[model samples]
Target chain A: EADIYQTPRYLVIGTGKKITLECSQTMGHDKMYWYQQDPGMELHLIHYSYGVNSTEKGDLSSESTVSRIRTEHFPLTLESARPSHTSQYLCASSASTGGTEAFFGQGTRLTVV
Target chain B: QQPVQSPQAVILREGEDAVINCSSSKALYSVHWYRQKHGEAPVFLMILLKGGEQKGHDKISASFNEKKQQSSLYLTASQLSYSGTYFCGTASYGNNRLAFGKGNQVVVIP
Candidate 1:
């Protein structure tokens, strides 16, 4: 039962609202990532963390920021949400030794009206 | 840049077979395969390293060609459970980010 988890499976909020999507893993993974995807579209990496206190922007630019205070946690926060931020956010984690495979969370669906 | 996938969508009947190809413009260090169903997280299928090896699991196999910068996933005797969007992720040497391909949507019907 040990796996990555995401909170607030679904969310709906107005524009200009602040939101944070929580992601955690119990598998002791050292690397974590955040990705955004629309239905039937390619997933775009938003942010990633290599370990505690290490976070970086991914290929696709994002308005959200992430914090890696602990190896088990990596959370993405949007200071001001907008309609453009409405998409499925997926969290993933992987081991440091071999980064080939990644374990993903159930993902959170965000709707900004 | 993201990798390109062939056959954007495919439909098959039970016990049929299919292949999904992913090609990148740059050299590949590794290839990761994953499958995601509707409204669910993507599940890891397998990973192929740069040595041009073929890996398999329960009739699902994949091959990586380092020189060609391409990888192909073969699903034999497809089942309903295999119906999902399959994504191929590639990473270069010493790179932390994974460049994923436009998913190949597969649907298996009875």
Candidate 2:
């Protein structure tokens, strides 16, 4: 099993509420990513971090922002949640070596009301 | 750019076989395969680097053709546990970001 974890395996909150999704890894990987996916749908990359203090927006435009304060922790925050934000958030990490496989966390299922 | 995956979905019986294809417009440096069961995170299946590589473990295997910038995933003698959505992520040269294909859903039944 991958040593990555995502907090709040499931969450339901009202619209306009501010929320943060937490992701942490124990593998000491240099690259981490956040992906948004709907049930049985394609995964859309939202954000990624190459290492601590280095973050970038992914191909998919998302209202969520992330910060990589430490190598082991990368958290995503939304200023205000919306009904359209309801989806599954997955956290993944991989070694900096090119062409390496990425390990994914269990993912957090969020429901916006 | 996002790769294109063929046959959005497929169904197979235990002991049957199937193939899923992923094609990219960009020059690919690597191709990563992942499988995600319902309501679960995607699990890494394998990765094929450039130079026309093929790798397999058990009944599952994949091939990558650098010249064509395409990859094919082979499922031989499938099992029930193989039922899940398979995704292909492509990485271009000098780019660390991986662009993913939509996904291919596979259902293996007994």
Candidate 3:
């Protein structure tokens, strides 16, 4: 089984509330990524990190921000959640190798009402 | 840039075969395939590097054509367990991040 894990499997929060989604992996991977997807839609890359203290925005724009302070921990936070932010957030980690497979977490389903 | 996938959706009966194609305009360094069931995270299926090699896992296999910047996933003798959304992610030279295609939905019926 993959060692990556995401907390709050499901979350329903009111608009304007601040929320944080947690992601951690024990696999000692140097690359971590976050993706957003709507129900039955394509996965859009939002944020990714090459290592601790190195984060980059993906092709897709997102209101959320992520911090990578520890190699095993990468967390995303939404300052003011909105209905438009409702989507499933997936966290994945992969080895530094170029062609290695990425291990994904269970994903956090967020709903902003 | 995200790759383009053909045949947005396909349905097949058990023991049948199908192919899903993914193509990119940019030169590719590697191709990754993943399968995701309803309400679940995508599971890695396989990875093909620039050598144009073919990799197989169980009855499912995939081939990468570096020259044409395309990849194809093959499902042989489809099983009900094979029903899911398949996504192909492509990585270009000098880049480790993968840009994924829209995805192809495959349904297998018994």
Candidate 4:
């Protein structure tokens, strides 16, 4: 019942197009994160939110921007998509407990041509 | 900083055992393990805290060494379902921002 969800499991957009990846969690978690990963590679954190109205850039610098308007919603937007932006985007959520394990969404695969 | 995983790939037969190691350059507060199937997001397996203890999930187990800033995951009596990419994510200040290591691909043959 309680879980993280990502919309548009797969997306194919042309370069220069604006795209938004939607992430929502019903688990009532206070911490949410977005990670970008390539096939067979490690996941790189691109954005994170401590709570509603709180957003921060992650360790890996990304061209995309994220906004947290509500506790359950965190969306990532790219003004001009590029081929290099094509990758799997994963959304995760965790409670405020320092040692709590995070739950991840199914992920969205974006492809830019 | 990102952690480093050893033995990028390994193959094992059903009922075999294997160990994957992950080391971080910075002091680690916790180590998390996850398994990702082909074309899917990773599923959390377990988390080991700073006290250097072991945690288990089914036939999978892991140990964290806070002093060494390292962790090791062990799979005993492997099964076909265990075939996937294993990733170790470390956090210096708990779960705020995790730095993942290069995944270790495990293939368990029947």
Candidate 5:
């Protein structure tokens, strides 16, 4: 079945370290998004891509950046990690932004020391 | 802006019923619902579009109120499998982006 996948279900990194969270979808969706959530907190949109070569910052200001070089892959990178960056990062994809249900990946839990 | 969900948390016994509401200040084109177990990704439950369409899986139904820019998920005869955090996502103006509510935690004890 078509699905979204995120690598490194859990990650532990030290401060100032660089890390990349990989998200890939087999559904061939044009719209992709990344969300951050802390325990018992609401999900916050951090980054999104409309299509390949198109990326935008989301409602929440995040230190991470994402690239959409291919339709199936949307990866988020943190140039420098911090304790505050520790949270669950969720990846989602939809056929279109106009109308459709999003499919989410298992998610990556990052622990920045 | 994020949508508001009522009843931050609720506990229910098996076979009981409950309703979770999601409201948005902005006009909505569609509303989506999902359930997430602890440490798991949120799974799509249903979606309600404009024009008063209602949809969901077996026993789990939902309704949308276009006028109120809100939606409600109704759980009838709850089951242990239904115990999880429920979230409502609203998208407006055909925007691909969805604003999700904080989520409602539901626990069904047998």
Candidate 6:
């Protein structure tokens, strides 16, 4: 089984506060992804990384940013929280950036009030 | 672009079969399937590459129609454990970015 993990299973914060969601994987996969999902909705990719020292914005145009200083760690940060940013943030890893199956972390549910 | 998933929701009993479809407008080279239960992250089920390839994981199988830029997931002998939301992800030619469909919520009863 894939050994991906996300910290802070749930978070509720005040508006304008800065928050960071942590993601880590033990499988040493080369590709990592971050997605934001709302209830009963499809997941929206906010950011993804090809490998260490590489990060790219996704199609959703999220206000959050990500960093990939290490291959096993990818974290998403929101500078200023808003109600709109309240959603489930998921992290995943795959062998490659293209055609491989991705293993997901448990996910972090953030609620910005 | 995001793919489109048909039958947004489905209900079935154990041992029944169901099909979930994913269609994309762009030329697809890969299709991925995932299942997520309530309050959990999605788990990858399988991946289907171009050239009309079919893959199976236990009783869960899927097919990719490269020519039509579509894919279908087949759940055979559905178990209550299969109850969850199914999502289909697609990657078009020359693109590494993955996009997902609206998702199909499936409920398998005893």
Against the true structure, whose TM-score is highest? 3
Backbone clash count for every predicted candidate, in the order shown? 0, 0, 0, 0, 1, 0
| DockQ for the candidates, in order | 0.61, 0.70, 0.72, 0.68, 0.66, 0.76
Candidate 1 CAPRI grade: medium
Candidate that scores best on DockQ: 6
By the DockQ metric, which is better: model 1 or model 2? 2
- lDDT winner, 2 or 3: 3
Q: Write the per-residue lDDT of candidate 3 for residues A1-113, one digit (tens) a residue.
A: 89999999999999999999999999999999999999998989899998999998988999999999999999999999999999999999998635699999999999999
The 0-to-1 C-alpha lDDT of every candidate, in the order given, reads 0.89, 0.91, 0.93, 0.90, 0.90, 0.90
Return the TM-scores of chain A for each candidate in numbered order.
Answer: 0.95, 0.97, 0.98, 0.96, 0.96, 0.97
**Cα lDDT tens digits for candidate 5, A4-113:** 99999999999999999999999989999999999767888888888999998888999899999999999999999999999999999999763688999999999999
lDDT of 1 at A48: 81
Model 6, residue A107: C-alpha shift (Å): 0.6
What tens-digit string does per-residue lDDT give for candidate 4 at B9-69?
A: 9999999999999998888888899999999889989999866799999999999999988
Candidate achieving the largest lDDT: 3
Q: Which of the two, 3 or 4, has more DockQ?
A: 3
lDDT of 4: 0.90
Between candidates 2 and 5, the one scoring higher on TM-score is 2
lDDT of 2 by residue, B31-103 (tens): 9999999888888899998668999978999999999999999999999999999999988887767778899
DockQ of 1: 0.61
Candidate 4 lDDT over residue span A13-103, tens digit each: 9999999999999888888999999977889989988888988898899999999989999999999999999999999988853377888
Runs in model 5 with CA error above 4 Å? none
TM-score of chain A of 1: 0.95
Q: Write model 3 residue lDDT over B15-94, tens digit each, in one string.
A: 99999999999988889999999999999999998668999999999999889999999999999999999999888887
**lDDT tens digits, residues A10-107, model 1?**
99999999999999999998888899999888889888888899888998999999999989999999999999999999998888523458889999
Q: Which lDDT tens digits does candidate 5 get at residues B23-90?
A: 99988888889999998889999888774778869899999999988888999999999999999988
